[model samples]
Target: MTSEELNSNTTSKTQDNALGPAVQLTDEELSANPEYVLEQTLSTILSRPVVCDEESDVDQETNALFTDDDDGDNADGNQRTSNENNRHKQSDSPQTGLSRWKPTLHKPAPSIYILCSLMSVKVLAENLVLGVITDLTLAKIQKYYEDNERQSQKEFAKFQSVTSVIQGLLGISLCSKYGHLSDNHGRVFVLQICGLLTILGSLANLYIYKDSTTYEFYSFVFFYCIEALNAGQMSMVAVGNSYVSDIVSEDNRMVCISFFMSIMYATIGIGPLVGSFLVKIFKGNSFNTLYVALFLNVSYTLGVEFFLSESRTVNERRESQSQYHNEVLRKNLRKEQAIFSKESSKWSKVYHLLKMDTLIDLFKPLKTLWVPKTALGSLVPRINVLILVIIEMFVGGSVEGSVQAIVTYSMFKYSWSSVEIGYYYSISGVGRALVLLLAVPQLISFLKRRNYVALPDSIDRIDMIHLYLFLIFVITAFASMIVYETNDIGSYLNSLFISLSAFALPTVQNGVIKYASKKSIGQVFAAMAVLRHLMSLIAPPLYLQVYAATAKTFPTLFLYIPIILSALSLVLLQFVKIVKDHDMLRRQSEASFNNFDEHINNYSVNTKPNTSFDIANNLKNGKSNLQSNSIPIETTPLFKKSHFTGKDNIRNSYKSLRNSFVNSNTPSSKNSSLDKLKAQNFSAFNVPPSV
Candidate 1:
């Protein structure tokens, strides 16, 4: 019978069995058979004949079945399939195609790099502006209250405390809102908005000084907004950090993150120094001096937005989806695409892409830490989190809190102009930047090398790195305390100690994060944030209370907290050993292949022969190299094949062998030919342990 007649009879038989009614077989049904399916589908979809020897019998029948009326639907499917095939082809094409568009060394796209550098500048500018203005305003207000006969000193003290409390609350609220907005919008956009608000608020403060009575109420409002803007600036920092994390890979994160932080702290030091100089320039006209800061703030924001490329691809994709949604036809088209793409749904693609799972993942570390360990493996990650949290709390309470208190205290006690204060801060900034840029990379490289030598097969070396960081913090804290307490010390000596302390922080912070369990990175970070905010909340009130108690005596009561916090941190450093033990045991259990010696010996001996013959044999035989090597020893099959077989039997036997080779080759083709050969070779050389 002809191929068409055989196909028609098969379709009739299938219909009789299934539906009890004979039905004519369409070209689609004839093409669905295993031998012709792939070729027929490719030809119909690509609008070209698919070269395949196996499909020769059905090709004539398929061509005859294609009519003018069906050509439209076929053409549409073919166009779609062609577009998809082109995309696949493009992706599979060599990297050489992209080489022409690759950035040259000389004509680099330095905007992103420039933006990264400016982040340090922003950190310094924001803190400096906040410090100088807050300090100067509070000082002037205190002096006014003390000199005025209308206001009691006691009442003034209460008013100052209340104002600070109100400012703190405003800061918290604004920071939280800014974080939410940053997630919804983007880091650059939110930062720009905050910058504009800062400029407007500063200008308002300037106007209030010129027309004190008319703008009195508005001035207070502007100052309140400025406090909120300052808090919003903190959110910008968190956004910047999140953005950096998104762009940087985990392996090289420490050095990059340390550089980022070093620049920020260095800027922090420089900002106040510059502000102090500006204060002298404006000479008691604090409001006028702030205008210069306002200008810098606005310019920084504009520079960032215009120059800094968006780091989040998911955010960019969501934006595209939103823009596409605006057109009714495109929205429907997307819905259809969603139906075909099983991986993502229409609504979910937008929502999932926009959601920052990294931020959400921050909470996981905390949950992992809190869970009771069922085994030694479980205990290590949890203990690591505990150690990291302790470290974060100690540093957060001491360095971060003390810096804020000192800046405020110095402005009040020394009567130093903002310009003088800014100079000292700038020195500190320069020192911090130099230390972080120079020291951190060397430290990380040393730690990596040490890990290789000490524990070649350990995943727990990250924990040892964390332990080393704790030791560094301990030394930094001691040096800082000694420098601050020694009155005979030169200004440069004190500055040197402070800069060293700032430099140690990034290494310590990055170390804790690097060693942290992956699932809980976000939560651990959030918990660290909570610890920081809590300390921030407490430090101000404690400083104020100490100042109140020691008003007539030494103003050094404010410095007492850093010294005490430093001592407490040293006490916590002892717990690092407990974490180290847990890490070692965990790594031992997780080590998959303990018989490294035998595997190495076998691997070396088999290397050459395995490469030459094993892969080629496996490819030709259509059998995995891991399977039995013994060929089938069938005596009857030799004589049976030697005699002349029926035409049907010969055709069937040849068809079976062809199908097996085609099926075997098709899946392996998904990977590169070289990779497939390597995999086959490796499997052949490594014998599985006998059951």
Candidate 2:
């Protein structure tokens, strides 16, 4: 029997079994011919286990039985085949093949890597310099006030508090402005400049103090500027962070940023402790220690310029070359085509590209608490920013306040000399350094892994973790303060807890800031600077007010502010949940789009014309027109149509299944889709044949 005849008999039997009866329709019988119709009905229904060319042909008797209406349907079948061939030709066009060359992931040059590393070093150096300067200057100023005995103790105390307030305000302003500047210019360039300024400022302060005996207005201005410069050093760190974001992929960014931040905070902790010990070695001449800080800053600046290469390539250069080549090629190809006399000017194109209106729209984040959802409809990225701001504000403010308070408290209460305060701060610095160098980096790495595995969808887990850590430090610090106030805890324990809190505070603050800054380095840093400054503005007054209010009964009135702040921080933690949920959904949507785009790209690239039909005809006719070396065409199934009836239902069902899976997965939903798809398909195919 022929292939057509065998196909007809099989179709008749299959139809008989499925529908319980078979009618004698000529069109149906013709479609049953295996050679002409290719088992159209069954191929359409089953849509799987497709037969290739090598498969055995249907029996001849089946073909004869289905030959009644073959002549009439022949023209229609040929037309359908021609239309499909046309579509296949279009699908195989060069335009479709061009889709293969999509934007692939590119790694930044080695110089960028070197610059990033140097930036990390600069962060450490600046923190160290700040610690050394603050400790030394405060010590000298306090001693001078004491020697003169010009003012009463209460007045001196108030004066010192006022100095702190002024310093905090100035620090906030400088840091915020520089942070914005670093966003505009390259991070390395701005950082190098900042480092140089720090070195100069430190040296100038050192030189002026050595010869000056009288306290003058210039002295305060000089130191104030120095303090401002010190605060502005943070901008350098911000610039480094922005660079990291620019270089790293989204998948690997968190780990790299977390490592950088951990190192930065670790240095913050160690700087003071090292400075204090150094102060003891230098005796009472704390001013001399400025030289060492100056050296570190200058060295870091020089190292950056010499070793670090610029990460940002000029867009104008790339655009000019691309446009030149494209225009030349186009002109060559279409010599007869008239060029437009008035094409839009380049400046106009640039103006439109700049989108000043859209740029202005971004400013809303600064003024408002509400975060805009990204294209993927996820709020996680924005929530991550908010959480960072909150975490930095409370924790950053506390650390700055506590550090100042410790210096003042040691001087007034313990009667420790400049050397003693420096020594204590240096020890605290060592603890901080250890955390940054060893403990914090490891902790950040672990947290990041947990974030990827457990909360892969959420971008703000790191921020949330930071908030929790900040709360722990705040509560512990407040409790220690309370104990000290009530005379229930020893001075040793109080000092130990205070030092520990200071060390831990920066870790939490840096972690959150680094995490948020991972995506848009400059913007996040700018926003953080604004928040930190706001905190600085509030912290001094709030501390003073609380101190004044509780001073009559409790000597440690500063303790209450932390408790209030800590409680407020906990409230902020609730928002983290909202942000995280939004981010996860956004990521899933983005991943889905990316996968779809990739599939389309792959399909477009791989599609080609099937020349096998022409070759087969040539072979049958004994013609020699075909090329002997031509690549073999891959055979595709003749019938492409399948039962699309349940597609929408399947999608809906799958969506529902995915939702359940996500809910059950909780912290980690990474594998839920694969598991759900497999389970659904397995159960679907495993069902027994219908009776």
Candidate 3:
């Protein structure tokens, strides 16, 4: 038979069956079929045939279960099958042709690398001229002091030192703002604007370079502060981490985070080397080198604008859906030649932007960070995760503050030069890159394989095991620092240990981040940055003061402070209550009766589609179909499908007579007998019930 005829016959046979309405595909069989449906839907949408990946067939089978249609219909086996066929018919839709909007980077890797590189370049450039700018500013500020050279330079140096920490604190303080901007506007937009601001600030610094007056110096400082305050870098980190998390669902999050972080860490290491090389090339002409870096920074901004795609979840999808809906409505209205009425006006739209609804959305990240309950009244890890994150940040910050102290220790103890100091700083960068590339991934793999670590993504909870790992690294770092020596090998070994000890910090950072509500990742990171920045403010001054007092006499005593702080953080982790997301509670609420709630909801919606109309039409059709196909037969000789049993044997003796009457169909006599038999049956007389 022809394909059309074959399909029609199959449909007719199934539809006309006696139990057609009651029959259903078994769950296992039904489960096997959604890929065929999703493949059809995507084919319709993208205008290209997409076979669901072979390895993911099992996973994609469940994907359709989660994906509901625009009209909120959760497709079932029969509905999905029908929808697939319908989509096949409409595959020629013009929306499917997207050649004009083709993206440059078809994969995640290139985009991630470029973004990380841009950030790396920015920080690298800034660090290169930071010292020259500081010294120049100190010279400018020296005029206010009446004391001799020693007093003027000393006070200015301390003040200038404060600027670095101040820049950090201010930048960290604005992480939240830029994070909001990233989410509301776009990550790349945040990058571009912030990069431009930095460039402008750098230019301002250049123009005011020779100004020995206090006002111009402060103006330069203020502009530079503006540059740091809008720290596009930290915002990018949060956004980039989130973006990578979204794209890579493979082997948990370690692979994606590890690779991206590795490249980023390597750039940071290479930056100093580049900066030192540039320093030599410029031969004390810091301004010339600064100008070159500024140019590259601008170029990076342009690259960000043109090349990087926005990584926000809600903004991108919501805007696209809105546009698509409008396009569809416009097309339909045009075809019908109907008036395309506008909703309210542009003024009302503008006014709505000021409404409380917009305000609530603006503060949703805050709510997600501070509030315990989520929008669905589900539990979130607002308190516990924040506490742990704070601890991590404090410990990290205290350790970070030890940088200058270590430099002091190196200089006073080992007599290291400027170039040697740069090399020393680069050691940590190398160590960090090594950890990112090797240690983090291996550790995660070890823990997961052993099943000691909870699945962070699935449960949305931080495992204490991660905390314990962080502790191990911290202790190891402390041990390495305790072994600090004046020799080159000992110094390098100390640096290596410091790096190894920090192996778990980034993992813990990513871990605590996961523990937070996915909706508030940016805000959580902001809070984290603030705590770190706050620590930076506290520890640097403290470390510097302590080092200045004791470095020549007892340099290693300074190292003990971080070790103690690390130990305290480890103890604090024990108190941190690791709250999981409500995923488990939700699962428990649903698992009984094998998804009964979902089934009931689906059934209610299915049975009540335009309740009155559907009830009337569907019931009538159901009744008719049930009635026609469900006629019962009597155990008589005329009914060949029936067999004689009990009273049927006796009835069979009279079957020939009954058949003679039934065959003749004398209307008056036969109709009454048939009607009586259909109405009721008795054991005394062999009578059949109605169908």
lDDT of 1 by residue, 540-649 (tens): 66776676677568655665555566566566655553333433443321222123222222221212122323323323332232134322212112113321233334
Error of 3 at 171 (Å): 1.9
Question: What range of 10 consecutive residues in model 2 has the weakest lDDT sum?
Answer: 682-691
lDDT of 1 at 7: 53
Per-candidate Cα RMSD to the true structure, in Å, reads 14.6, 18.6, 18.1
Overall lDDT per candidate, in order of appearance: 0.46, 0.47, 0.51
lDDT of 2 by residue, 32-101 (tens): 3322232232222222221111111111112222334434255335434544664564333311111235
Q: Residues 1-691, candidate 3: write the lDDT tens digits.
A: 3334533532432221110111122233223332222222222222311222122322223233233333223334544554465456333221111212544443243356666667667766666666666655666656656436887777766666666766775666576666565544445556667777777877777666644445343555566566675554455566667666555553456556766667666776776567557767889665566687678778767666555655655434333334334545665554334232364565544544445344333333444345343323444345555555665666677667777777777777778898787777678777778877887677667766776545553222234655566566665665665664646555556566666655444555565555554444556555555556666677877888897888668767877777787778877766655444434323211211122112212221223222233332432333332234332323322222222222233234233322322322221122323344333331111222221
Candidate 1: global Cα-lDDT? 0.46
Report the lDDT of model 3 for residue 673.
Answer: 33
lDDT of 2: 0.47
Clashes of 1: 20
Poorly placed runs, candidate 3 (over 4 Å): 1-110, 131-148, 210-216, 250-252, 313-384, 446-469, 483-492, 546-556, 572-582, 585-597, 600-691
TM-score of 2: 0.53
Clash numbers, per candidate: 20, 24, 0
